[model samples]
Target: MDLNLRKAIKSNVSGNSADQLEATIVDAIQSGEEKMLPGLGVLFELYWQNASEADKDEVLNALEQAVK
Candidate 1:
């Protein structure tokens, strides 16, 4: 089967409001289901693509702290 996960995730969440998006993310994380990872990754990819260097640095710093 040919499946495009990023395209599928984008199509599902496109046009969502900020609160709705947040809810979706929270639900996905709280579910702790492996199936939701691709969706989260797509969301992160979207954020990374649009983020400024400063924003990227901030996220990286947060991730570094999170891993510690």
Candidate 2:
């Protein structure tokens, strides 16, 4: 995890519109830098915390497919 969580914090993402959030996510992935991982982890943690069990299972299934 080499992400700069502070930069995202500065962007005040809690108020982000859908497009802004999407752009942030896209930029992080496209950068392909190892340091962006912590930011992604934070995003994933947020999702995991809020997701239902079915959603978690679905995500795990897809992840399983990709990692194979």
Candidate 3:
């Protein structure tokens, strides 16, 4: 069977409230599981899709700073 992981992750978290979403991100980060990375990437994709250009730039800047 072919499974689409991004779709699955997005669907799972689609209706989450801000607090619940924050909890999901925090849990994923703190748990440090490799499996959680895909879900985090999905969440980041969602945020990127909805973010303003300035917000996107800000996030990119922070990420660049973090990686340096």
Candidate 4:
């Protein structure tokens, strides 16, 4: 993936709900395995489409701590 594009996606995640972020992360990992991480945005959008606000918050919080 292009470094600039990755940076752009990272920026899209600021203040994003946890469910949304998790879906993105999952997509990234899945795509990365296929050498298709550049397509992670689609996963993020998919998750966002179905996730509840609470689900998003929970995933986001878990992600913040996990990354630390």
Candidate 5:
């Protein structure tokens, strides 16, 4: 069984608008299920790839603060 999780996740949210994406993210986080992590990760990867350096730094700072 070959599962390309990133591809799958991307396909699932491909056409979503910003509000729709936010809803999806919020729903997944509220669910608190381990299975949702990969999808979140793929979403983060997409964001990271498109983010500017300043934006990336902001995200990293937020994540660092979140874990502190």
Candidate 6:
């Protein structure tokens, strides 16, 4: 994926507002396929763009764990 898409995915996963993130994540989860993950990337980008350093670190840590 592109850097922007990666950043976006990271952001949505760590956003402060639960409601928007919840709906977006639910949609992605319900889709249940790699094909749908990109749509979620849009929201991810939005959240990631505004994320704090601490939040970014948390997300990166979780991602590292998931990768294992």
The ten-residue window of minimal lDDT in model 1 covers 1-10
Using lDDT as the measure, the top candidate is: 1
- Per-residue lDDT of 9 in model 4: 61
| Model 6 spans with C-alpha error above 4 angstroms | 1-21
**What are the lDDT scores of the predictions, listed in order?**
0.97, 0.83, 0.94, 0.72, 0.95, 0.75
Model 1, global lDDT: 0.97
**Residue-level lDDT tens digits of model 3 in 1-62:** 99999989988988889999999999999999999999999999889999999999999999
Which residue pairs in candidate 2 have backbone atoms (N, alpha carbon, C) closer than 3 angstroms, thus clashing? 2-35, 3-35
lDDT of 4 by residue, 24-46 (tens): 68777866675546556555665
Candidate 3: Cα lDDT at 35: 95
Q: How would the candidate models be sorted by TM-score, starting from the highest? A: 1, 5, 3, 2, 6, 4
- Give the winner by lDDT: 3 or 4: 3
C-alpha TM-score for every candidate: 0.96, 0.78, 0.92, 0.43, 0.94, 0.60
- After TM-score superposition, the amount by which residue 58's alpha carbon in candidate 2 deviates from its true location, in angstroms, is 0.8
* Stretches of model 4 off by over 4 angstroms after superposition: 1-35
Ranking by lDDT: 1, 5, 3, 2, 6, 4
lDDT string for model 2 (2-64, tens) is 866756664566877889878989999999998877777777887899999999999999999
The runs of at least 3 residues in candidate 1 whose Cα sits more than 4 Å from the true structure, single-residue gaps closed, are none
Q: Which TM-score value belongs to model 3?
A: 0.92
Count of steric clashes across candidates, in order: 0, 2, 0, 3, 0, 4
Q: Score candidate 6 by TM-score against the native.
A: 0.60
- State the displacement of the C-alpha of residue 56, model 6, in Å, after optimal TM-score superposition: 0.3
